[model samples]
Target chain A: MPINSKIVRRIGDLARIDLSITDVDMFSEQLGEIVDLMNQLDGVDTSSVQEMDSEIGNGHENRPKDIVNEGNCIELILKNAPETKEGFFTVKKVIE
Target chain B: MSDLASLTISKARDLLSTGEVSALELTEHYLQRIESSRNLNTFCFTATELALEKAKSCDRLMSSTDRGKLCGIPLAVKDIFCTQSLPTQAASKILEGFVPPYESTVTERLWKENAVLLGKLNMDEFAMGSSNETSVYGPAINPWQDPNEATPLSPGGSSGGSAAAVAADLCLAALGTDTGGSIRQPAAFNGVVGIKPTYGRCSRWGIIAFASSLDQAGPITKTVRDSAILLEIISGHDKKDSTSVRCEVPNFEAALNGDIRGKKIGIPKEYRIDDTPAEIIKLWEIGINQLSDSGAEIVDVSLPHTKYSLPTYYVLAPAEASSNLARYDGVKYGYRATLKDDEGINELYKRTRSEGFGDEVKRRIMVGTYVLSAGFYEAYYQKALKVRSLIKRDFREVFSKGVSAILTPTTPSPAFPLGSKNKKSPVEMYLNDIFTVPANLAGLPAVSIPTGITEKGLPLGLQIIGPAWEEANVLNIAHRLEKDSNFRIKPKQWWTS
Candidate 1:
């Protein structure tokens, strides 16, 4: 499906990127090209090829030993910040 | 002391161990060189006093007989990896002022080995660019001299800082993360040696995740032996990183000395894409010649699904990154946007993220979110995952057919100009990773070794890829190539100029 302005606006807003009108038009064209390229995959015969997540084994199913508190010193980690408040970084107010 | 900057970590350690040179003196020499070469921009933050202190501490350890392989050796940690005392911004504004309370596992390992911390090197924001120009700080200039190429050249990203630092002698060697070709591409551009070990070999506890599935921290150094020694110190299992394998880590130092007399090396047919430069093709041929001369048999192999690598990588890496970066919302940790009287949580998040992430990073997150969205998952992400398996299967089949390793170019082209993409579309730049992304998708080990230079004087790299946990083979061959090749090149005087 071609990316219309509505989809472009949704993606731009969701991504929080400030895209100019020029970028929107360019990106629309690019997205169309990408979708067209992806459509080529439709021709491949995957009747015998079983879908797999990883080339390696599916290690995600088997959980490893639980050891949650492996993080390092909190004080040293926050030492070189430009701004922080109560262990959290502070930035310019993003919304009204 | 003039040649002090050019000495490899192996040579530096030998000299430092014998008390022929003090660690403080060595650190001062590089610090002075860095101060003079402001054009290189190799370092994002040069912690001179901290480096001296670390060197002094290593000196004490050396005097007390607790010296390890890297004792008193100064090395830079790529800014993407957290360092306890230095800024760990990962070259992005969102991470500004964010320093980790603890060092990354890899950085800690380097410290444990008594490798003196030089400082944090610059990189593309979140390890994203092919050229180092995407860095928040500025592009790191290629230290190679080329009168024809008067403009500053990019030391390839996202590990451009580490590669440039090593190339310019700011540090004997440095650590860099490879998600796609970050380490290898920069290593090639800077005319150095870099290795991205097989996935799961190195722990990724604190390296900022660009794409978790593809990210592996590796060493960028002047020679393959130095890379091996550094890898020996850094590659191992860390419980904090669950993806790290618990298998016994081989002694890469010892493996480097192994005989390659009867090794079967495969040259991948697919890596030679259309419009591949004649120089890069020549570099690959020279690499084949070198390996054949070293008593290794060469065979032509094919990775049939190679063309699908860039698209698959774009999907998978962004999908993983989108999930990984979700933690950076305004509330729990870094980059919280101050809420106004009327703004809701959603608005705050949108504002915070908008202000925090760079353009490329945001684009990736959007791409990732789109592909992984519930409705599109089956069509985009799942199919990409399936194609990923076919790509990996191609490698497994060829490797099982008795090919020990695959040879390819780390990039289709050498280092582009620092601002080459100012006018080029983003996809044009993304296509540069086409050659290097396949190994990442397959989770195999690969190395970039400086083979030769273009007539323009930019260094070219020969990529050696191996099966899972075959870093030993990769490093051995790269070492042999470096030993035999007449490429005794160094950074331009701009490094000292």
Candidate 2:
């Protein structure tokens, strides 16, 4: 799992973080080292082990009744938005 | 009044009850201390007016029969926890100016207990780095320095400010989150007490999520008893966070009876890695002897999967962080990059994240994205999950063998100079969490108590880890160690000068 500049670029795109050529080269080298460190897991035999997704394994199914417990404060919800129009969070046009 | 800043929460509570010190007087003393100690860079935001208001209200209720447990105690929290109408930036540029409209459940609980807030402490951006250098506000310097040497040392990180502020007596205690070793490591570095309870002991709702499963809010305090008092207030089930366990919050402070008789304290041989400084090993031996002299039987145990904890944590935490951080695009809250007219939504996300995130945060996001990508998910993320299960099973085996708690050195070495390690490689910095990450993987309760000092006069800590939901047992063992070790060393208050 050698991370090259091309793979770093792809990862940057997937993560939606813009990276320059210098960042790509630097990340390729650094992430290569981190990946090498993570490669230690390949040596351990996990065949018989169950994958522990959450520390508290049994609590996922616990859900409260479906109801709108709290809402209706549009001002509070949009308070921190970078831009808001007509009480909705405004982003660059998704489709023009 | 100046000496009021040195009192622990327990002592302060007694003083408040006896009418010897009003809550307003205590709050004013800490506010003055925080104002004078600005050079340490511990507090990013100081809510002086709000703290005075809260303290006045607390003084009004001083004679009431029903009062909160932490009624007059002044404390600060890592900026990662949301404080409603106050700045809750997570110490990252991306979250700049993002004041959360609602309080985090943990902080809400603290308020319900009538604790005074001295505002938010600084931390690594998104709690990613081992040193506090990644904070947008700059690194929080450790108060402890070699008296002969002028070079400042690091307050081991992520929760660096929380630990440093408590060490410097800027606040009585501070709340810090431990995802890997964010709480314990800094506590070790600053020569204070910190505890990370079982994973679901405290609610995660309204906390700026780092790694959801691993992130837990705990207290960094001047004493083990203060840690227990704060932990009791913050622990319990909350409807807002489903992961918060539905269990009884024990009387943790009351459990500190200093009785460890017949308790089997485990010393896992696997923690003894080569190249560890002789001071750390020697401090660990002193801890073992202290516990043994206190009548607790020391047993040799094996947690063989311990070595894989750091690798597993690195894989899982970032994969979750990459997903959690995806919400910080330009659309909603926080910083948004200025875009050219032709740019669209994707460009908005890219530029905003690139400009907003720090280097270590970006590096983690990259590793997380790469690992969770289409082809590498099973090899990295899935394999790490199984190794996590093995690590949990290893702890379970030891605890099942009647081991009451496991004692280990909290960090590999004492605090170093601020910029010394992270320069060469990020992996060098990652090794600082080696001794503390295993408990997070297993989701157990662990505490760090300052028990020894390095030859350079920097403090070293010994960690006591207990079974899941057994924070009471863990605190009791630590309280015993704290009593036996009698560590009373405080950092020189050079910052105030």
Candidate 3:
């Protein structure tokens, strides 16, 4: 049940999140407890079960062609951008 | 005046058509009520200018008799949906100032029907908690409260604000999304009818993704008929949402009055949990008895997979949600938490996300990540999904065996007090969705109707779930029960009281 600092750091890395030692320790215990709770699913027999990737799979047969931003209110969408400039959202350089 | 508070869409439409009340007047009435009841926390944000503008347009359309089904009806949208002009924060600080430039398909459809927009109702942050307590704006107060209790009771979450707004007569009805009982639970808590349509019936585009696979936007309304009309307007296919169905969307409003004279209603034996309160059990029995007396056959059906639904939902929903919510990395759309010196972009994302999401959401995200991890994928996430299929198959088998619909209590108990946080253990809190989560897992349509009240006088709801796309059948039975029960239960004490 004790999620040590190391495991927390690994989890933080996996999730692409940075955690302070204090947060790492606190989240470790909390996440550990939640995992312990989720461990209850171990007893459930899912031998014949097929994983549910999507909840509703009935409607894809006649789906329209992938509408890339089709009929979308462009101005409305841009309003969501916190740093849009000239219809493009500006972001810090990732590769540089 | 058509008593703005008690007006149904059908009535409002007829009156509006006859020039009884302008859309502007109806919008103003509700806005005034919202202003007075600001302390109720029923709404997160109100777009008065936008609403007035839209109402004027609706009035202009009415002059030309351009009345669509939801024409002139002012709808209070749940904060979960994105609006172009409004801040679409899911009652969370992470997305505090984030405004979605796009509109959710449901909201867009409402606008197409000339439905006047009222405002956004508050909700639990990211639709995680039951009590709406986790919301950054604070928990919404139930319109009704016990005399002994001075503090506001929880209006049930994630859709607590939507339910409270309708129950308090702030708006005709509102949109709410149900992912693991979000809509139905709050409807039960606030004594309103909430329907979570069969998955894929309504488009999920524009609604903030909670549990992608399980989430469906439905109407939380005062009457089953109102919910049906709202469903008719909102339920349809959109090219925007890949998951939307191409099947013929039924005329739900016309089907509302259909005869349920001899339908077979299944009583899932597993729904009667041992921990359910005696009063709730009694209420369930009364509902069953009422259905039976009305010429519906009550058959004991076994959904053997029922017990596994909550756990399956917990695993599956979090797994999907963790993936869906990965888009909100501060830089793209939402709030960015500035990292300390020496920290880079990765650290900023980590800090922002960790700080942004609340405990329950974080816990789910972690579980989701853990389950979807390479080593654990096959064992956990994949395994839970398989159980999910079996659960859906169980409902199909029951409905196939001459059962038109399944009946059960929405929650194990009535609304707990707002701060009754420590009363139930986490597992117990998870069990609150035991009855409702199965319908979502199966992608079947279901509704929660206020069938009865507990001995202590809090409202208890009975959920009626039907096979996929059988929304009409479910609403018919619910309407029949609504009339038969005649519970006439209102909030115990209004805000003024």
The order by descending lDDT is 2, 3, 1
Q: Which of the two candidates, 2 or 3, achieves a greater TM-score against the reference?
A: 2
Per-residue C-alpha lDDT of model 1 across residues B1-497, encoded as one tens digit per residue: 43787788888887888888888889888888888877788788888888899788777877666677788888888899988756788888777767676679998998887878878898998898888777788888888766776677888888998998888888889999999989999899899999998888888998888888789999998888888998888988787888887777777878876467889999888888888999999988988998899899999999989888777777788888887877666654456666677666676667677778876777677777777776778787888778878888898899999998998988888888767674336777777788888888888889999989898777999989998888888899887877767689765575555
Q: Is the docking of candidate 1 incorrect, acceptable, medium or high quality?
A: acceptable
Top candidate when judged by DockQ against the true structure: 2
DockQ of all models, two decimals each? 0.31, 0.74, 0.47
Candidate numbers sorted by DockQ from highest down: 2, 3, 1
Judged by whole-model lDDT over C-alpha atoms, candidate 1 comes out at 0.80
The C-alpha stretches of model 2 lying farther than 4 A from their native spots are A57-67
lDDT of each: 0.80, 0.92, 0.83
Lowest summed lDDT across 10 adjacent residues in model 2 chain B is found at: B418-427
Q: TM-scores of all models?
A: 0.93, 0.98, 0.94
1 or 3, which is superior by DockQ?
Answer: 3
Q: What is candidate 2's lDDT per residue for B56-107, written digit by digit as tens?
A: 9999998887778889889999999999999999999999899889999999
Which residue ranges in model 1 land beyond 4 Å of their true spot?
A13-23, A33-43, A58-63, A70-96, B336-340, B422-424, B495-497
Best by TM-score: 2
Model 3 root mean square deviation, Cα atoms? 2.5
| Cα deviation of B456, candidate 3, in Å | 2.6
Off by over 4 Å in 3: A1-5, A20-33, A55-59, A67-96, B423-425
